[model samples]
Target: MTIDFTQQALQVLQIEATAISQLARFVNDDFNKACQLIMDSPGRVIVSGMGKSGHIANKIAATFASTGTPAFFVHPGEASHGDLGMITKDDVVIAISNSGETGEVLTIIPVLKRIGAHLIGMSGNPASTLARLSDVHVCVQVEQEACPLGLAPTASTTATLAMGDAMAVALLNARGFSADDFALSHPGGSLGRRLLLRLEDVMHTGNTIPMVPTTATIKTALLEMSAKGLGMTTVVDKHGVLQGIFTDGDLRRILDQRYDIHDTLITAVMVRNCITAQPQMLAAEALKLMEQRKINGLVIVDQHQHPVGAMNMHDLLKAGVL
Candidate 1:
């Protein structure tokens, strides 16, 4: 007999949807109590479970740790064999079991309690032994299993996972956690580069900067722009202080005005009020300013207002700051 793939998929979706819908009812005072308990914990939150619930517990622990709550996942079976030593008085223990009676998890409860760890029990049964012994019981109960066999933890696991995320995000908001703090834990991601990388790390410096003195002709500025390939040249005084910028846009305007490119001084045709960035500013912030001003490039200056470096939209793009 061939299986009806569409029917099977619809059945799974129906079951999972019902499970998620039922989670709203679980968001009562007890949920707040659980959040409050975890928020008050002074040490790490140790999440432990068995079977599929254990898998979800590990993800929950990771979410908590990345969002500013110190947390980790421990195997209940390992806990019974001396891994319980990792539990400290300054830690909180979260135990997950669909039936609330996983023998392995139950075996470690006494040790966790003895160590003065606060217990948060997540289960489908509110009156189970785990819930009865917990400092806070978070009911992740569902009406039925998404599994056709009604044996695999399906609906209950979905509800449990959502509740775990709710707990983590709530604590994150309450703690005033920032993106910069989150980036520290995820230094390899794009968000980390935006938050931690400074403009000086990517801006063009030395001979790479397109620069010309105020006495230089528009033709001379054009040569500097072409050689540096930045499409613009910074108009500086003899002291190297930036006075203005002559971009391709400025060149177009000058030509339209019939200025003599060979005889006209760059300062006479340059756009005075050019957008600038500080060397110490965050590259991400510079990108934001560029976007807001609708400009394609910026001159980076030192504390003394001397032009030291420059970058354009292409530079930010190449650096992945775009």
Candidate 2:
């Protein structure tokens, strides 16, 4: 007898999808009340559960913490021994259990209550003891498990995770969390680098800036570009004000015209009114601008329009902003 694994896989997907769809109806006043309690709590959200629900609870806690909800997970079994001290009166406890009668979880309810912590219960059975004890009950009820024998927690766990995500996102929106705010908590990730890295952080500054005077000959500009190795040089006036930019492309065009590099003023051959960036501009934003303009380098200028820094595509790539 050959097992049709593909058909079984599709059946499980459909069942889990249906379970998530059914969760829409459960996002009612009780869900809103739960969000309000978590928002109003002075301390962090304490999440606890047992068995497969415990695994889901750990992920829910991580999601909440990353999305600005300030939450952490505690094992129900550990809480009975010594971890219950992690909960405080100012905190909100979110307890998860499919049966709602898990002995380890139920054992600590009285202690949590005695400490004056608010309880939010998530269970598949709404009429279970955990639901009655909770200040707000979120029912993650699903019709059936995606498991073939209806024994393993499949669709039920998916529904619970989706519900947790919904709650975390609702709180995130309510708090007016911005991308920059999210990036703060994820400083070591790529998203954080894109949002937090500034042009000044990666641009070639000080003596490394490729620059030539507006009155300098094209030959002098070429020397500056070569010395800095940025393939371009900014042409500035006597007061250090930006006059224009001359690049290898401009040199190639000038060479095509057979202009004398020794005699031609850089100002006459450079690109006037060139695209520039400020020091505070984001590197990601600068990369977009460069791609849009089909340019390889940018001159960083200050309020006085004086060139302060310079960077090329290689710099952005090295800085991980490419």
Candidate 3:
């Protein structure tokens, strides 16, 4: 017998996609009740299952933990040993079993009941043992498994995982979880840097700021821009108050006018309405402002409008804010 690999793969994908689509009906009142139980609990959420369900349970726990819900996974076999000690009555436990009668998962049901932990069960069978024992049962009943023999997990696990995500997202919305909150749970990489980094953290400070006095020549401003390498220079008054900004772009535009850079005041050609940002503004927000203004650099200012710091697109790239 010859096998068609692409057709087989397509069939599996179609079944799983259908499994996900059928999940909306399961997101009914019982789902909200389960979310309420988790929200009202004083302790964390515990997720547990056997085999393939265990893999999905682990990811679900991670999603909950990353999204401001305190959660972790415990293998049902491990829970039977001594890991059950990790769970408390205040915690809510979400148990998974496709058949709803897995021996290892079932073995811990009475213990969970005795401990008074709120139980949310996920099972493909509504009439199964785990579902019957749960405080709230979420049915992940799929029409069929994607497996050719209907023995492997396939579509059932996909539906169960989808339901878990729906639960986590609903709870995330209910709790008003924000990007800042997510950054706290994940502070290791570009994701954290993007969310947590502020303009103050990356801007060049004090002497590095490109500046030329209002009385200075455009030639002086160009020299300062070269020394600072920001492609721009701030034209300020003797009082150290910002007056305007001159950029290499300004130089290009005024080239045909034949004005002598050697003698012309920078304030005469500088952008008087240049945009500025606060030192405390988010680097991400600064990036947006730069794009919107179609400018390359920004002067960070204090409340008194004195330049406190400066940054450009290259600085953002080096800081990984890009």
Candidate 4:
């Protein structure tokens, strides 16, 4: 008999879906209390488990850390040998075990209790040793395993992970954590750059900006555009305030009208009502406005609307926002 991978995959998915759905009924005061404990802890949340549970615990710890909570994963087997020192009195411990009788996890219970760390147990069996020993028990019990043989941890781990996410998000909401706050914690990622990297940070400034005086001939403006390579040049007045913008589009329009580029005044053919952004605005916001307005470039200006910097779609792409 040949094994059907598709059938096995479907069974696993169905089993886990049922397990997670059943968890809805278990959301009660105890769940709220567990969240409160993690939220109130001054020290980090230490997650510990063994085998498959350990892998799930590591992910849960990462989720908590990224969502405003200070958390780290500690392997239970390692904890017994010496890693238990990482748990301080001010910290909270989250222990994971499907059966709640993992020997490595159980070995550290007394030590964690002795060190004055608050214990929160997550297990499939509420009456198991781990749950009974903890200060609070949040049951992640599943009716069945997604594994066809009912041996591998599938549904139980999925449900446990979902419950961990709920805890992290619940606490994040209670703490009034904002996108900016999350960005501070994840400064290297694209989302972080989107939230924290301002237009001023990525825009080309100083001589890199393509500029031309309104009174300049189109031939001179083309020289500035060529020097800057922004494919466009900003037109300004005697006071250096932006008047209009001339791009390759303007050149095409002038040529179609049979006007000589060398003889034409830039301001006469420049595009008015040009899109602009402030120096302090987020790069992501500038990108959104450009995309929504169907434009490819923007001039960054100061409070007086004087052009300070300039950027285009390519700039955003170079900054990893594309």
Pick the TM-score winner.
Answer: 3
The TM-score that candidate 2 achieves is 0.95
Question: For residues 1-322, could you state the per-residue lDDT of candidate 1 as single tens digits?
Answer: 9777998789888988888878888888888888888888788999999989999999999999999999999999998888898889989899999899999999888888788999999999999999998988899888888787898888888889998998999899999999888989988978888888888998899989999999999889999999999888898888988899988887776667888889988878899878888998988999999899988889999977788899888988887777
Local distance difference test scores for all models: 0.89, 0.94, 0.92, 0.90
Give the lDDT ranking, best first: 2, 3, 4, 1
- Name the lDDT value of residue 82 in candidate 2: 92
What is the lDDT for 20 in model 1? Answer: 83
Clashes of 4: 0
Model 1, which residues run further than 4 Å from truth?
A: 1-4
Local accuracy of candidate 2 as per-residue lDDT tens digits, 1-322? 9887999899999999999999999999999999999999999999999989999999999999999999999999999889998899999999999889888999999999999999999999999999999999999999999998999999999999999999999999999988888889988978889888999999999999998898899999999999999999999899999989999888888777888889989888999999999999999999999999999999999999988899999998888776
lDDT of candidate 4 over 1-322, digit per residue (tens): 9777998788788888899999987788889889889888889999999999999999999999999999999998888788988899999999999999999999999999899999999999989999899999999999998777899898999999999998999999999999989999999988898899999889999989999888899899999988998889999899989988888766776776876778889878888879888998988889899889877778988878789999888999999887
Q: What overall lDDT, based on C-alpha atoms, would model 4 receive against the true structure? A: 0.90
TM-score of each: 0.94, 0.95, 0.97, 0.92
Predicted structure 3: lDDT: 0.92
RMSD of 3: 1.3
Candidate no. 1 TM-score: 0.94
**Among all windows of ten consecutive residues in candidate 2, which has the lowest summed lDDT?**
251-260
Which residue pairs collide in model 1, if any? none
lDDT of 2 at 248: 88
